[model samples]
Target chain A: MSVLFFELAMTAYLVVAVLFMVYLAGRSETLTRACQVGTVVGFLFHSLALGQQWIAGGGFPVTNQFEAASFFSWTLVLVFLVIDVRYKSHVLGAFVVPLAFLSVLSAAFLRGNVQTIDPGLRGLGLTLHTSLILLGATAFCLSFAAGIMYLIQMRLLKSKHFNALYHHLPPLNACDWLIGRGVLVGFPLTTLGILSGAVGAKFVWGSYWDFSPKQNLSALIWAYYLVMLVGRYTLGIRAKRAAYMAVLGFVAVALSFVGLDALMGETRHF
Target chain B: MNLIVVGLSHKTAPVEVRERLAFKATQLGEVCRQVTDQSAADEVMILSTCNRVEVYAVAPNVDDGFATVSAFLSRCADGMDVKALGPHLYHYPGNDAIGHMFRVASSLDSMVLGEPQILGQFKDAFEAALNAKSTGMVLNKIAKKAISVAKRVRTETKIAENAVSISYAAVELARKVFADLHHQRVMLLGAGEMAELALRHLISAGVREVVLSTRTTENAHKLAEALCAEGGPPVRVVPFADYAAILPEVDIVLCSTGAPDYVIGPKQVSAALRARGHRPMFLIDISVPRNIDPATAHVGDAYVYDIDDLQSVVEANLEERQAEARKAMVIIDEEVDTTARWIRSLEVVPTITALKGHAEAIARGEVERVLNRLPNLGEKERKLIEGLGPAIINKLLHNPLSSLRKEAQERGGRDMVETTRKLFALPDEGAAGDAPAGGDDE
Candidate 1:
């Protein structure tokens, strides 16, 4: 049942992505409304899918790679829907929806990679560690989307090419603000995610410090985002520089979460 | 009835003639009533803008309506003779007129193609005619359809999305840099006509405040006072020497100084960007020989566009508008055909009614003649015989009448109406006179 709902949600997101692309090419209020409706429908199915998973697994469903990726995308869509309604930035969906679709697509492909969590590890500490990290990653995904838009808009501004993409994009300040906000929200959550993960490690692995590749990479990803947050607020590294950092930090996060885990076969830490 | 449009636009008439013929908004209702009263037209509307003054009318005869409206137009303007206005006037009848109205309302026929003001002007003219009760069924339907068609064109095409003027281009560029101008400040360095125009556009876009600085203190103070009187965001006058100090605080800077050298350079802009924590700033230099250093564009987060650059942007946008205008024309053509067909269908109603009435009259007369010969028959039997006559007539006429109605809604439907009239020996007057009334109920 959970798989069925996940597939349904993925199909809705795919349709939303296509609608947004058409809207970007030829802007119309009707198309925007359609995209909004599609997003809401997809979000509902996604929530149902997650709820089904939670009930079936007897815990918050972020234990395995499939559940983690699915949760990441669900949170991304949730944040996008909030921003879309609050800011009335309908065009932002053209950039964000595709990322959500791809995240869910990866989860579908990794469906067989679910690792059964030990019953002893089913506690608040493990749930917090996984859910907080996934939420933080979701925020970074927003920054990544905003960063890409900023670079495209910046190039258009510098080259004086007011093409369709340039016109559809949000203003440079808006993109920069999103990038800043994402880092601001993501950094603290990541800090707590790392701290909680370490606390959970003592109970499960019999030691808090293991120096494993997954643990090392998680620390590296957290530090990278920390640099971005500090550079944006205190060091005056902003606009183009901040956009570049946001993009690079997301790359590091992706590498640590997906690449490092894949390289070390049969890893206990995700 | 024929739908006709008789008037001159900027394309056919000079400004001297157009201005003289333009009707005042307050006088529109009276003028429309006068046209309907004096002309052969049953319905009348006057659309008078600075670029064009057109009279839309539904008349019994196209030639007579055109002549009457042309003469009235010449008389409305003082010192303009009919011979002088004759060369300027243009007349379109039937489908041509409907197509023209759609194009005009959509701004496809505007002097500046794809402008937005013409739609509002068209609506006002329509409202005036409605207020005066000068427009009947035909004019009202056409006018309403034109308004919706204009809205459709605006949404379906990017015809009015881009700025076509330099000052408006500045505003568009500013918008591209700042998501919302309501919180952003603008600084005007020195004074020039184009610079002030750009400043006005920015203020209307909801800029937070305006900072004015000029080489002369008096000019700055006067400009500030004038801007403040406009009742927008507050305007502050800063001394020329202190203008650079507020660089980091302002988001947009407009420079049009008369100085021989550059008033703002890369060093000052880069310093300001650093102080502002690298927030983006838009610099527009409209001064001759340039007021801001061109190299400032290389500075991160600072976009510098000079006069030539702004002009190029306007040119590019105009070209895009022209391309979009072609697309709008296609939409207009499709709607014109649909509306024209619907209007033609109105002509079929009275013909069908007449055809049904003719058949029933013969049936009733024959039934009465036969009943007189069978006075001894029972009451129920007599009623059944009377009903049989009309029932046969109705069944025989149903196919022909329905086909006539169907043919009337397609192209070349007029020939079908004429043929049906000749075949049935129906009076032509009913088809012409009852069309407007039939359309009213619809």
Candidate 2:
């Protein structure tokens, strides 16, 4: 049942991504409206799929790559819509929804079928830890998209060349604001999640500071976001410089997210 | 009924002759009344713009209406050669008249093609004619259809998309950037004729707040005072150094100065973009040595269009309008066909009204005789019997009425209408259309 819902959501996101790209290509209002409607419908279906997975496991169904990726994409869409409305930069959707689509699409291929819930996962602490980490990751994903747009806009400005995309992209100031918001919000959530996980580790493995690969990656992710915040606020680094830092941070986040699953064989983040 | 248009325009008449024949609005009511009082036309409207003077009328007979209007036109401008004016005065009758009107209202017949002023002029003429009690159902229907045709030509075609003038082009591009100009603020970075012209267009386009900033405070104050006196949004004078400081709240910056260096740089705009919360800003640099930095176009959300860019936009727009005018012709043809069919349907109105009246008279006579023979009938039974007569009459006439309407839409609809009118003994004067019940919506 969860797999059926997951496929349905993937189809909706695919439609949204295609329509948004078309809207950008031609500046068509009809296609823009269609893309907006598709994103909203896809968001609803993605939630239903997450709910089905949760019911299947009788908990927060974030125990594998498929489940975590699905939740991550859903949170990205939610944050993107908020930023899009607040900034009045609807063109950002053309850049953001594709990121959401790719994550959910990759989830469909992963081993996402429901499995027996481990007794170690049966608690509020682990549930809170996983949900917060996925949400924080979604915020960082948005920062990555904004960072890419900022660099493109920066090149256009520096080269003194004008094109359709140069005009359509949000002002460089808005991109900077987007990156700042992601770090400012994502940093605290990630901190709490890491702390909660270490606390839960004491109950599951009887050690607060385990040398597991997942723990090491989480710490690395936390340190990177901390440096980004300090570089922006204290060092007075912002705009293009801050955007570059965000891209680097996003790369680190991605490696630990998908690369760990590929390189380490497994992670207790499940 | 007959439709006729008699006028002199920029096409055939020289400007001098047009001015001579033009009727000033002050005397328009009196002149329109004189023509209508002569009973030369059933309905009359006068459109007297600087480019043309036209009279649209519904007449009892085309020939007599033509004579009366031609004499009126000749008398409007005394001392002008009536014979010389003869060659200038042109006339269109029947469907040709409607086709001419639709084209004129849609700006196809304008001296400046795709210009919007003619539609407003036509509407003002229509309202004047209505106020003078000179137009009725047919003329009202024609006027309303013409307005819609003009509107469709504007929207469905790209005829009005690009601005034709330099200042207007800047305003048009700004409109494209920001959909609503009412809430947008404008800042003029320098003092020059180009800035003044662009400012005028922006004010007319609905930008209500303006700031004038220049290197010299006195010059800025002088321009600001002059602009405020010109009847627009209040113009505030700001120091030149404050341009970047005030840039955050402004939605548009019109820069035209004799400066050798860039007045607004990318860094300044980047800072403003951040301060303004990333709202899009339109920078129109019309000076020869451009005032705003060209690199600022790369700023996220800042759209820069220089003088060259605006000129290219105008050139491209002219070509677009030329392409769109062909499409507008198709729309005009459709409007003409629709109006012709409606007039054809109206041609059969007298026959229907006459036939119904004739049938009802006979129905009433027979029902009265039968009721007198059955005086013991109950009230409900009496009412039922009375209702039966009209019901039977209506049923008997339904087939013929519908067929008559169908024939009105065919190739020989006018002939079908004429034959029906003769068979029913109805007059060609359109008696039913002039009746109170036949009046169009108020």
- The number of the candidate with the highest TM-score is 1
Q: Rate the local accuracy (lDDT) of all candidates.
A: 0.89, 0.80
Residue A214 of candidate 1: its Cα lDDT? Answer: 81
Clashing pairs in 1: none
- Among these predicted structures, which one has the highest DockQ? 1
Tens digit of per-residue lDDT, candidate 2, span B190-229: 8779778999889988897999898898998988888778
lDDT string for model 1 (B1-442, tens) is: 6799999999999999899999999999999999998888999999999999999999978999999988888899788888989999999999999999999999999988889999999999999999999998889999999999999999999899889899999999998888779999999998999999999999999999999999998999998888888899999999999999999999999999999889999999999999998888999999998999899999989999999889999998889889988989999999998888778777777777777778888899999999999889998999899899888988998898767766877754678878888998988855445632653233
Chain B TM for prediction 1: 0.90
lDDT of 1 by residue, A1-270 (tens): 888889999999999999888877763457888899999999999999999999998888888888888899899999999999899888878878898898889889888766667767768898899999988888898998999999999999999977777877999989989998998898888889888888888888889879987888788877777777887778787899988988988988877777776787744755
DockQ of 1: 0.64
lDDT of 1 at B264: 93
